[model samples]
Target: MDLERPVQIVWQGPFTLAAAIASSTAPSKGVYQIYGQHIVFGPNSLLYVGMTDGQTFGARLAQHRDRWLVHEDDVTIRLGVVADLDSSARLADIEALTIWWHSPPYNSKNIWTYGGGPLRIQNLGARGRLHPEYSSHWKPARTPPDGEHP
Candidate 1:
């Protein structure tokens, strides 16, 4: 099954949304390296470094969000494809090095998403990932509780 669920990156005019999805498909299973970071746009305009392969790359970004819904929040999870061995000293390196590189943009936070660390769903309805904890803490004032509104 394809692990990297395709997503669109809504950027400036130079980069069209269609272009991002065409390239963001998940890599094969053998093993891929990456640097992923979470971004929440609200006039702040910042970015993070992230990576993934046939595993968590696609959905994890969606995990680090709020409104549990993709179309609702400003945070967009993105993973930077990092090629080369010695990328990480160990498996833990995945989270360590990547988050380290994008620490400032990540607000000095550590990324919990890693090679099948958790939250792996092999089916559609992927948007169910929209859980309160997965959402960004900084959201609209009266968005209503999880089930109450959405």
Candidate 2:
């Protein structure tokens, strides 16, 4: 059986509090990722993956403007629209799969249970972090020159 892959990032960029609030393209319903160059999870950077159904991306992103930023000046947002996952259940599945694959610092790595049972597991690491369709377009995180701190 073939395993699913990581969600694709359709759009991504560094944003400030004011920029995030003003961006109109982020007002869609989908999954989002927040990456920070801080020590939230550990020394190897941090990525926070989340999803939104009823709430628009713009609104949800705006909410994070307050406390989500571990590094005020070093934060980037990656937005991925799960076209296949038009339902809430599918959205949650994608979110869970992403968390499992990347094991981002901000996400829980514990066994996820639901409806009095364990959540179904799948192999999502086959295609790397971003979904296969968008994986080719994936750009490694920008790093400092050499001696410069990230």
Which lDDT values do the candidates have, in the order given? Answer: 0.30, 0.53
Residue 120, model 1, lDDT: 16
Model 1 gets an lDDT of: 0.30
Clashes of each: 15, 0
The superposed Cα distance between candidate 1 and the true structure at residue 135, in angstroms, equals 31
Q: What is the C-alpha RMSD of each candidate to the true structure, in Å?
A: 14.8, 10.1
For residue 85, what is the lDDT in candidate 1? 24
What local lDDT does model 2 show for residue 55?
A: 77
TM-score for model 2?
A: 0.59
lDDT per residue as tens, model 1, 1-150? 122422211111112222333345544211112112234534323344334434544444444333232343233333233232232333234333333323334433443322323221121221111221211212223343465431
| lDDT score at residue 26, model 2, on the 0-100 scale | 64
Residue-by-residue lDDT tens digits, candidate 2, 1-150: 113443333445445546655767664567677766555553324467787778777788778776656344466666666544445776676665555445566665411322211222322222224434322122234443566442
Which parts of model 2 have CA positions greater than 4 angstroms off? 1-9, 14-17, 40-44, 70-73, 109-150
